[model samples]
Target: VRNNGGGHANHSFFWKVMSPNGGGEPEGALREAIENAFGSFEEFKKQFSEAALGRFGSGWAWLVVSNGNLEILSTPNQDSPLSQGKTPILGIDVWEHAYYLLRQNRRAEYVEAFFNVINWEQVAKNLEDASS
Candidate 1:
């Protein structure tokens, strides 16, 4: 029951992290923070997208803020970083339901579209809240 609750909560936040009209680069402290933590925005995107695609089964990809740094990670089967002591700044549901309607098995294409719809403002706010 607790695990099911966690999955629903995680998926809820995941939907808001993206929109039809979101994406590009993050701004303000989030941008600077990404640069500092991952070396550059491009690198950050590459790492994040790679992590999203690398997961072998149903799961999520995440950008989490931990110890004042940003990190990319993957969690399988409804697991969330919230359970691991990290704050989730951004999340992408790699579960097939997230993309199967539009992308079928083309996970990479789905990931690319995911980038096109990232709510960076929400991510920045999450990062700020987490940092503080």
Candidate 2:
């Protein structure tokens, strides 16, 4: 069930944190948290994108809250941070299947485009949920 269950949860969470009207810097508490964790929004993007791109195979890049701290990490296959007791605030699927149709192996392009549709509000809610 690890694969199927994790895939379902991961993909479900993935879609939830995206929106047609999304694509802007997060604000409020979430913004401060991000800045504190990664120095700045631009730096966060850079590091997150790098983590996503660095995954060598089908997997996910995640921004997770572990032990009350924000972290950037990658999970292979359909793995979820839940297995490690971490809370995923945001994530991006790095599996080729997620971007092959449009990016055709150019995962970087898809990762970049994903920024344009991120549902920061949902992410903030996730952070709050995780925190509480």
Candidate 3:
């Protein structure tokens, strides 16, 4: 039950958080929070990418809001940060089906490509909602 539900919710969130016109750096409050949490956006990307790449298999990496702070987390299978009382502001699916066709076995390449399409505006909205 939870697996199916989580998958549906995660996929829905995933689709909304990416756009063809996305990428580049965030602005305003979202940008500040990211820099505050991870030192700099580049560092956050490095850590987030490492989290995605380090996952053993078939999982997701996320930027979540927990207790009014931001965090990077990795969850195996179809699990969600929601279950842990965290709000996922951004996430990336590392499952093979998500990248096999384009990235083959190079998961690092796929993770890097995700930054190209990240919907920072939408992610900022999510951060605001979570903060409230």
Candidate 4:
């Protein structure tokens, strides 16, 4: 049940967390928080992509707010940060099923493409909601 529920939540969030018109640096508090945590957006992306690639198997890489600080983590299968008491603000589904049709075995390509569709506004809202 946990796996099923987590899977649903992860996929649901993935859909809402991105947009066709998305892709750009975030603004306002979300941007500040990211920079505060990662030094820079480019660094954050590098780290996030590292987490995705390091997962070792089918899983997800997540950017979550932990204790008022942003963190990057990867979970195997359908696992979610919620279960660990963290609030996920962003994530990438690294499961082959999520991108094999488009990038084949080049997971790095999918990761790069994912950046082009991130809904920064939604992420800012998520950060606000979680902080409150």
Candidate 5:
């Protein structure tokens, strides 16, 4: 039950991280941070997508700000970065429930749509909060 709660929390944040009008490169501090941490935004996206796609089962892919750096990681089931003492800045739900409604079994397609709705502004805010 607690795990379900965590999954819900993570999923809620994941939904907010995206927007219908969001795809494209991040700007401002988030962009600079991405460049510094992951070499480039493209690289960051590639890593993020790979992590999301690689989850063995229902879970989440995350971009977390930890120890003054950004890292891409995947959480199994309802596990979250909060549990590992990291601050989650962005999250992508890999659960079938999250995408089956829109993309059916095409997880890759769902992953692609993620960029179209990424809320970079909110992500930047999360990063700022995490850093502070």
Candidate 6:
């Protein structure tokens, strides 16, 4: 039950927050908020990427909004941040199916590639919605 629901929800959110035309940094208030939350966008990326790679086996890494702040976290198996009442604005699936075809066993490379396709605009919108 947990696996089915979590994977479905996570993948739905994941697809919504990525695009082929995505990449580059976010702008305006979203950028400011991320800077405040993680010091800088680069730092946030580093932390998020690290979290993604740190997950062993099938799992996920999330950038979640909680109490008006952002956090980077990883969940093993099919656990979802929603279980803790935190709102996930962005997430990356580190499961083998997500990257095995292109990145093979190099999870680090897959994590790096995820940044290139992230739809920052959508993510920013999610942040706004979650905050309100």
lDDT of 1 at 124: 86
- Clash pairs of candidate 6? none
TM-score of 6: 0.97
Task: For candidate 4, write residues 9-116 as lDDT tens digits.
Answer: 999999989999999889999999999999999999999999998888899999999999999999999999998999999989999999999889999989999999
If scored against the real structure, what TM-score would every candidate get?
0.95, 0.98, 0.98, 0.98, 0.94, 0.97
* Candidate 5 error regions (>4 Å): none
Per-residue alpha-carbon lDDT of candidate 3 for residues 94-123, written as tens digits (9 for 90 to 100): 989999998799999999899999999999
Give the runs in model 6 whose Cα sits over 4 Å from its true position: none
- Against the reference, the lDDT scores of all candidates come to 0.89, 0.96, 0.95, 0.94, 0.90, 0.92
Weakest ten-residue segment in model 3 by summed lDDT? 1-10
Give the per-residue lDDT digits (tens) of candidate 2, residues 1-132: 999999999999999999999999999999999999999999999999999999998999999999998999999999999999999999999999899988898999999999999999999999999999
Arrange candidates by lDDT, descending.
Answer: 2, 3, 4, 6, 5, 1
Pull out the clashing pairs in model 4.
none
Candidate 2: what lDDT? 0.96
Candidate 3: list runs displaced more than 4 Å: none
* Per-residue alpha-carbon lDDT of candidate 5 for residues 13-85, written as tens digits (9 for 90 to 100): 8878888888787899999999999998889989999999999889889999888899999999899998889
Q: How many residue pairs clash in each candidate?
A: 0, 0, 0, 0, 2, 0
lDDT of 6 by residue, 1-132 (tens): 799988899999999999999989989888998899899999999999889988988999999998879999999988999999899999999999999998889999888888899999999999999999
- For model 1, where is the 10-residue window of minimal lDDT? 1-10
RMSD of 1: 1.0
